[model samples]
Target: MLTFSIFAVLIGLLAINVPVVAAIGLTSVIFFALLGQGSFLAMLPHRMYFGTTGFTLLAIPFFILAGNLMNTGGITRRIFRFAGAMVGHIPGGLGQVNIVASVIFSGMSGSAVADAAGLGQIEHKAMVDDGYDPVVSASLVAASSVIGPVIPPSIPFVLYGAITGVSVARLFMAGFLPGIIMSLGMMAALAVLAKRRNYPCSACRTPAREAWASFRGAFWALMAPVIIIGGIMTGFFTPTEASVAVCIYAAILGFAYRDLKLRDLPGILFASLHQSVSLLFIIAAANFFGWLIIHQKIPDKIIAGLVALGASQAHVLLIMMAVVLLLGCFIEGNAIFLITLPIFMPVAKIFGIDLINFGVVMTLLIMIGNLTPPVGMCLFAVDSYAKVGILPLSREVLPYLAVIFAVTLLIAFVPGIALFLPRLVMGGM
Candidate 1:
């Protein structure tokens, strides 16, 4: 009854348009009050503080700052040029560049919305002028943006690690192979679609020397992720330290390249702080909500209930994935992760699942939500940028979705795909 009441209050508040953070806090308060544990409310401040005060959590702000610094420092143009040089001769030339840029930018930003907002601008205009369907272009951009969180330095992984007690470094390593596989899968899907439609290729091949020049120009920008991942895997630094290292690296590169200016620091700092605060509040609220779940012994009850139903671990996992997908259609990714992971991670552990593999799978699944309807941040970001509607964009994203789902299933069944690299680097899980 208490559990039902918690969900009822939460869902009711959500239906009436209350903010997720507020809804979570209010529901938690109600649950405790009803259970005659009103004194639990006194612990709320400590829970909130501890939630955001982790050393690992420090990485979030640094990463956001580094990404914003790179953006203000003109790294995007370099990345675009390098992508153009590499793939501009293909059928659907600019579309291919969009995906390539996403794969590259994903390494640095680890944000789908940032990828969509930054890369979409250049790729969308190019595709439109090149005669590609505007809606399709927008959809492709949105889908490609998923690569951001799948790649290294992913913010989602950071949140997942903090919540699940998994190694953020291992999660970073585990994501690489799956991320590349997903990118290739999307590329192959695009190729098939392009061939079927007879999309136009670039009129001129990039000159060999010019392509080399562009690659050289973008080499430093490309190497940022390598430094971060390599340092972490080599035990040269923790994830938090690596984030600081990246910030310093980004700042140096920006100044040396004369792309980042003194004037930009204030804006970059403010933006990072704003984003960090918003995300931290959600994390804090989630901490209290998660505490209530524990106080209520929800995980044990859930496990017993599932056992009575004769559900296997795999069956439970599949059901959870389906629910996540459905919720992704309505809620933001961070909100979903904060609200659900605390509940699901316990269930996952009962099944002998590796938290690393679960982290990768969960990240990918949430990314799928970003491409779906209603609250798909990537979809809205790309569509708004391209000046297109969500319905048309959704239609155009079907093929991409098919490719994404295939990759997700592969990761689901073949844990090695996500685990192999981490094992190799970390010397076994």
Candidate 2:
């Protein structure tokens, strides 16, 4: 009954539009209050503190700052120019550039919102000016931004590792193929649209000299990921240390390019602070919520119920994936991770599934929610780029959504898509 009540209150709060952090925090508070555990209330602060105290978690803020510095340091323009040079002559023109740039930028920003609001602004406008419809342009940017978290240095992967004790380095390596698959899927969808709508090509072919020039300009921006990932994989730094290392690299590059002034540092720090606080609050509240669910043995009950259905492990995995996908439609991805991972991680163990593989699949599925209707944060973030209503943006994202879903299913069934690199590097998993 307590478990049911906890979920009821949570769902009710979310339905009425309370913030996700508030909804989660309230659910935990209401649970103990109803149970008359006044003594438990005092421990809530401690739980919240411990939840945010993981050393690996420090990467969150540093990565955010690195992304901010790069954005302010004119890295976005360089990467975009490089992508446009490489892919702008494709049938989809600058539309192809938007997807390609997203693939490259994903290695840096690691957050879809960061990519959408940052590089996405440039992509959306360039596409719009190139004769693409505003709605389609915004939709494309929002859809492609999903690749941000699907790739390496993913914020979601960091959170997942911190929560599950999985190796952050391995998760970083795991995202490579799935990210490429998602990129290819979106590009294919864009090509089909280009043909159907007769979108203008931005260029017939970028000159070899021009391509080399853009590549040289964006060389440092491109190398940011190599340094971060390479350091982590090579044992030169832990993931947290890698984050700090990347921030220093970004700062130096920013100064070298004269794109980031000393005055910009404080503004960049504050921007990262704002985003970090918002995410940390959710993390704190989620820990309390996770505690409540575990105390009630909710995961045990859930597993029992699933077993009673007599489903095979594969069937059960699919059912849980579907549940997650539905919840994602309403809840923010981070909140969904906090609420569901505690319950599902154990289930994966019961079914003999690889946790790393499950994490990648789950992250990709949750990312799809970022492109869906009503609560798709990416849609709203990219809206300013198009001047379109959320409804129109959502409608226009359908084909790209299908592409993402297909790639997700592929990764879901074939764990190698996510596990190959990790196993090669870590030598098992």
Error of 2 at 415 (Å): 0.7
- Deviation in angstroms for 342 in model 2? 1.1
Q: Give the local distance difference test score of model 2.
A: 0.89
The weakest ten consecutive residues by lDDT in model 2 span: 1-10
Number of the predicted model whose lDDT against the real structure is largest? 2
**Residue 40 displacement in candidate 2 (angstroms):** 1.5
Task: Give each model's clash number.
Answer: 0, 0
Question: All candidates' TM-scores?
Answer: 0.96, 0.98
lDDT of 2 by residue, 344-422 (tens): 9888898788889888988998888998867898988998656799998999999999998898888888998799999
TM-score of model 2 vs. true structure: 0.98
Q: For candidate 1, lDDT tens digit of each residue in 369-392?
A: 999887788998887779889988
All predictions: root-mean-square deviation over Cα? 1.5, 1.2
List lDDT for all candidates, in order: 0.86, 0.89
What ranges in model 1 sit over 4 Å off? none
Report how far off residue 408 is in candidate 2 (Å).
1.0
